[model samples]
Target: MVGRGGVLRRTGGAVVLGTSLLGRLRRRDPGDAILRRAARLTLVASVVFFGCRYGAGSSTLATYGLFGTIAAGSFAQLPGPARRRARILVQSLPVVWALIAVGSLLAWSTWAAAGGMLVVGFVVAFAGVGNPRLVGLASAFQLFYILASFPPYQPGTLPERLGGVTLAVALLAAAEVFLWPDPVPVSYRQRLAEAADGIAAFLDATAGRLTDPHAAAVDRDTRRERAHDAVTAIELNRSPPASAPTAAGAQDRALRICAAALREVLAEADRLAADAPAEPIPDLAAARLLSSCADTTRAAGRSLSPGAPAVAAADLDGAVGRAEAAYPVGAGNARDAPDVPRLCRDATALALADQVRVFAVGCRVATGARLVGDDASSGLFEYARHSPWTLYWWQFRSHLAPRSAHLHSSLRLAVALAIARVAAGVLQLTHGFWVLLATLTVLRTSAADTRTALRPAVLGTIVGAVVSGGVMLLVDELIVYAIVLPVTMLLAFGVGRLLGPVWQQALFTVLLTVVFAQLGPEGWRLAEARLVDVLLGTVIGVLAGVAMWPRGAGHDLRYNAARYLAANADAVDQTVQAVLGAVPPPEGALDRVRRRMVLIDSSYCQYHSERHDPHRQQLNWDAVLSAGHHVLPGAESLLRRNPPGCLAGWPEAAALLRDSAGRLRSAYDTLAEEATHGGTAARPPVSTRCVDQLDRIRPLLGEADLESVRHLVEVDRWLAGLADSLTRISPPAADELVGHRRKP
Candidate 1:
């Protein structure tokens, strides 16, 4: 009775769970899924009809279907209608010719085929330098080499095969254009809304952590990751295709501002958590302020949805004002001797209030209001525009150097292809092209990426072979194979998005088996052959990756990290100069600084994604980036503020700031050198002159001037902290130094 009851309970739970999942799916925007299904059906039907009418055999059908699949997949990744069309047209030219040339070479000589593949690998890698489309182009060429190898090499059939591939490309391109005309806009808006929500969630999490030092690290990490992902999504949507109408520019700017503001707020919250006073403030006013700010920011985020009412500027101002008023002013100075705990608490409260004010201002800007108080330029839209061809050429020239990532990756791929060819020849594998295909697909710019690709390729291939083999054994008819085709393709592409490469590859393998089964009677044998070939190729690819350019993503990470720090230091110097009225801030200086921050953030994320490091280098990098984020808005605020006229009287203060800027720049340069070249640069001595100058100028300044001085001091203090963090991580061990003396 007990066992029966347990089984009944389990059955009921399963039914409920299944119903819930179906309900969620039913609620989703079905347009994307419907379009995708239509495309797949169209592709399968076209391939089958053409094959039957022409009696072209299963190989020809498979080739055509594969081309269509590639086109659809690439089209789906593109951001705008215009961009998708342009990519299709441009990518098709090289792909068509490359496939023909590869076929011709294989027909001529095995050695010629190998040489041709090597050249294709190098050219694709080189052309792809900075552009993602070019990289995909290269990948397509490599993939064709593998797929085209299966058919018996015949010179007479080359043109026919090429024509079939062309037809497939055209069909898929048409489907993409007519069936889903404006998918990118809907996707972009959805992503933007999600990003806003992510930022709000992060702010809420940060507020919780301010009072609870023991807050779950997992919660903090999850929120931080979500916020970062949201920022990435927004950045990607920034440069839409020229043909696509821009979304409201102001709203986009507002989203960026909110993201930046949240980053600043989180940084301040981190500082408070790290340096909380031993005795808690009596009123817990700062905590309450944070909680209120979180709620307000979340509400503002929800307002970002399409047609949602804009938040009122007055409401934003009131919330900020309340937070500012709650801060206990002069509490630290009230005692004859400073009470350490009270002073710490008061300082934290004031800083927290300042961050809240910045958040409020950002919220106001997000409501589409013009900047009334401070110069409210976002600097987000101020980017250098370049033509696609010009940008491509520039990237090509830039990465021509030996140390460039593009150059290194191109060389690695070329060498890996050469090796795979030799191994395939020696083994005398019937489908040796599979080895080359696996090598091309699995090899990436870094060993880390290669390893990441390798596992899924092998696993997916095996799973695909096993599953398809089992299905083929049960269902013998051509009609059954036809029915299975669309379902497999949809499952592969749809589930792949959520599960990553594994499911996608497995489904791809299943598709291949189904195509091959129609061509021949030996269905089981073909499946077994595919599994072995895939395993062989994956193993060779992984080995080549380790042996070639073993440093992988780590080298790029250090180089980029160094470059980011150097750019940041330069921005600091520029900001100081502008503030001191020495020279007007260079046009787009802050924009350039923000771009550097983006690069650093991207590189750090890439580094973290590679292999899990026991040393927690990601945490250290995060600290540096957080400090840099604080500097960006601070510099922008400094740029917009009008320095008091009395500042002309204090030449010493101006001179002191310039000196500090130079020192900070020098410190960062040293750090950059250490990161790239593994040698320490000389650290500049910290000067007390800035403090002395501030002391002399403070009493002479009026209230307005006093506030300006306070802002300047805060910038200077943040700079010092940044310098210290860089210094701590810059120097290497004695053995690592070029001129170290060993102990006797």
Candidate 2:
């Protein structure tokens, strides 16, 4: 009876697992599932059909088609159909031709080929710096050298090879256009709604944090980051393809306006949260009102989707009115306010009411309600028009400098390839191309990344050899090989996609083994040789990474952080100048600054993922980044509230703000120089002139103008904090201050 129970339990477990797998497959969107399946099936069918038609002599042509299809698939993963088609057609052609030209030259003479390949590797690697498309092209070029090395070198077959690759690219492009194309309008709407929801959630959290001072800082940062990402995504989707109608443009514009307004509201909430009282506020009425506003904003977000009911303007107005009534402006008449706890409560209530008002107005704008007063302009969406050739030339020129990552990578690649070629030739390895392939696949921008890949590459190669040998021993008929080929391709592709670098390498090795097996009878022998070559290549790649350049993502982090600080300083300077009427704001200058922040955030994520740490360096960098994030939104708020004409009456305040901007800019320059050159400069003193001017001007201004001055004070405080943080991280030498102007 016990034995019977164990058998039943095992059967039940197997059934449950199988059902779960099937459920997951069925849960995928039908259109997406069908599209992916069809693409893979089409790739497999084309390869098989061509191989059969051309016979063994033209197997290289079939291999070319397989490679072209894979490359096109990588490009097709871009967001929209039109973009996918353009990238595949234009960006891919030159790369394909360049690969073919280089591979063909190798057939002429060994010495000439070695020299030419070294130069080509260096140039391609350098071109890839800072440009994702160029990096993909570089990989393709290396892949061609690896795969097409042993094919027949007859000049007569060149045209046929080119034609085969071209056909594959065309087929994949067509599939991308017709197969369940990603609908831009729907995606744009969903992304906008998600941004709105993030803003609402942030507001709710701010309110909660006000009531309790022990709220988690990490959670707050994560929410803010997500909100920023959502806004960026909306910006990217703003310009649809020309085929989209005028109405699409209008819809995109409306969404952008909504996102901008929500961003402003979030900035206000962040300020309020930061200034929360030490003692918990017991204002239940104000708390309830804030919660109501959050609920209404969430409903507005939902209404952004098609077929949902729009949020009513009246509902938003009612929430604002209740909040105002609960915490009336200037309600308390106590002169000097002796009770500190009571004053803190009153201050918290006032800030909450102000946030609710701002949020309600933003919600109304998002839902398309007619404004009762002047319509706030979110600025026009400006798109740059540059020809493809011009853009390519600019990329080339920008990365030509010595400090550029592209230049270093290119030089490193050239040296590595030359060494690998020389070593392989001296050893007289029959399959020397495998060494080149391994080196190309393993080496990356960072030593850490290259080292991380080594173990996986070696293990995957061994596993692939064993698997291929076993399969060959089990099956001997051509018909059997044909039947198993598609299944193997599907499994390998699926596993590679689902796993990390380790699994991806293993699957790729497996596919290569299967491909070579079809070429001849000595399949197991070739697999063993391939494994040995891979081991050698990985060692060389790791050594190159360690010995050359050696600086990885951590170095990139410092460079990018310095760039971000410099951009922020410039932004603050420009905003102050515009407000004082010193100079008109450069078109899209603020937007450009915000975009640079996004880029820095991306670089930080990449740096954080690396597996090295200098404890003090990481902590210092984190502090600088945190201070920068706080300064950015505050500066934007000050600009929005204090426009040119509004600040005309406060000349002294304007001058103080200008001086603060200049000091901050100077400090940033010193910081950037220190970060880049590893040489410290004297830190500028923290200025109090802005604070003093704000205090003097506050009593003379009206309620609206007073609010604007308060924002400027907040920005000034943040700048001081930033300067102090930088000083703590890297203090200057006394001798370096000889000619520098000291702050009085």
Candidate 3:
């Protein structure tokens, strides 16, 4: 009924809107990585599905083939270069085959299927603790098992189903290598190298500043920010793939600790550089120390690459010794008094020497001893060594604790999948896998988090249901459904994440509707069944969430944080004693602290994912984690840096250092106690006390080798960071702990 001009105007507007959308997509997905992936997946899926459905003339083959591509391509989230990803997929085939085989054997009854789901779901979810690649593939593995577990129990079709899956994976893996492959992401070692470079520059710049005190090209605060920024990049970018049970493992923990040590060095440098005179420097000892640290840190960084000249921890040790003999100790007020600017500079320089030595150990562990062989695979990487099963067993054993969110989440997943399987079986739904699919995708760590996402998901499902039902009612051409399926897939899978969870669910529903419509005879009733099954699954997911660990990691954040601090405090105590006796610190000290750190990271990750009540008090968890981060390295620095054991001639300094360690240990214990008992008291001096104590120790240094003061100053720097982090805890009130869960 419209005029030609009117129609032209409307069509022009549609074209403009589409163009705008395309522009936005380009901006959001920069290199079009999402589009590239969507296109690659679409081509592979279309070819596999069509060949099985029309060429092979087996509905089972077609169904498995299509879902196989979805599971592997969309769900697995394989990372790395295309060749590596393909290799990892090839290696995962045995596990996939076992899952399908077990799934077929268990689909005969509700009880068997539900029990299988419970056990299989737990194993797969819990396996993520082993490595990053395993975590990436977990959902795909779960999806495949769920697919074979629901309805039409036919062991006879296992061959076709398995063949179809193999075909899809084989083609997809080949396509991943040959097709438009993803650009290689920045490697973890590369990031570590970059961080080392940043630290080196900062230290070198600080040395220049120390040489010319009054005038500087760069500000101290600015240099510190740049160094910290690099550390942040390493934290965010590095995710080392444990490539083999023994062949894999990146020593990420070591890399992080090393990075932490470097960060500490920069901070200590800046603090000591504060408010000093601009005239010709009274002492070049501090300047030489900075230069040595810069050179040693740079060498360590270079060795992170595949083929760099090897550098040892001994190089750093030698550098410190040279610097110690580089300048004679002052004979005046500056000799023993830290309040004097000259002594303060010297003290700060010693602290840095301690941190750079820790940096050497970090480099050795991360580079697989290719660079520095002194401390490789000892403290952190010792347990995570060369056997895959050994690595897996250790990871598994470590995360088995009751407070681990990984354990709780695994349990929650098992329960939800089991309940969904039971519900689908009892209700006798024709396409029951949809029910399990809903439950698998929708359930969250806590009841509250699951409930938060429920409304949008349910609404999206209803909208999807209506649209799919309308498509079925209004259209009847068989060829039309087939023709549009791949197109729908491209848009759905590619752009879904760009939208929120609502659009993702809605598009997935539309995608499934088109898929099922082609596989068998169906009416609008298929759409009706999907809506009902999703609602049923949603209800089960929420119920299971409530029944299991209803509270997520935030509930245990304080407890775990406190526990972490206690372990770190103990590590410090043990290291100080070992240094005093000049022996290796107890081996168990590193192990306990490493284990606690892993637990805290897990808890912190889950805490962010969970839904918190708006009224609850916000905790400064970053500060707490940062504070805890300083503990082990600080202790290690103390143990490794001092040569003469400071216990001989420097009796007063040795006693003071020993006393300070006890005080820090007590302070950490008190902070842990407060964190445990509602965090009501202000944790004063956890942050600033060590810097203040550094002043007290400076005046008492009575005529000794300047290097003898290194161990105590390093310990103070560590304690200062630890105390600062502990004091930042703003814990929730007593009632807010579980208040969000008690909905009226």
Give the best candidate by TM-score. 3
TM-scores for all candidates?
Answer: 0.58, 0.59, 0.85
Clashes of each: 0, 0, 14
Per-residue lDDT, model 3, residue 171, is: 89
Question: For candidate 2, lDDT tens digit of each residue in 10-125?
Answer: 99999999887656545543344433744554464456435633464566566667766655553233333444544545557766766776666574545555676687788766
Top candidate when judged by lDDT against the true structure: 3
Q: Write the per-residue lDDT of candidate 1 for residues 346-379, one digit (tens) a residue.
A: 3343444444445445545545544553424334
Q: Rate the local accuracy (lDDT) of all candidates.
A: 0.55, 0.55, 0.71
**Ranked candidates, highest TM-score first:** 3, 2, 1
The predicted structure with the larger TM-score, 1 or 3, is 3
lDDT tens per residue, model 3, 1-744: 579889999999999999998888888789888888888888988998889998998899989989999899888866567898999888888888889988999999889989999999999988877665666688889889999987688999999999999989898999888888878877666776787787788787777777776555656557667777776555321232321111113465556566566666666666555524466564577777788888888898888777786567676667667665553355233345433355456656766776777677667766666332435323544443456577667667867988888788888998899889988899899988888887876687777778876776798899889999999999878788899989888877787655656777788789888988888888789899999999988888878878888877666766897898888887777766665665556568867887887777657645644566555545545445655556654555445555335554566765766777788788778767665654346555443333455567667766644455544554455555555545555554443333221110
Give residue 372's lDDT in candidate 3 (0 to 100): 29
Ranking by lDDT: 3, 1, 2
The deviation in Å at residue 635 for candidate 2 is 8.6
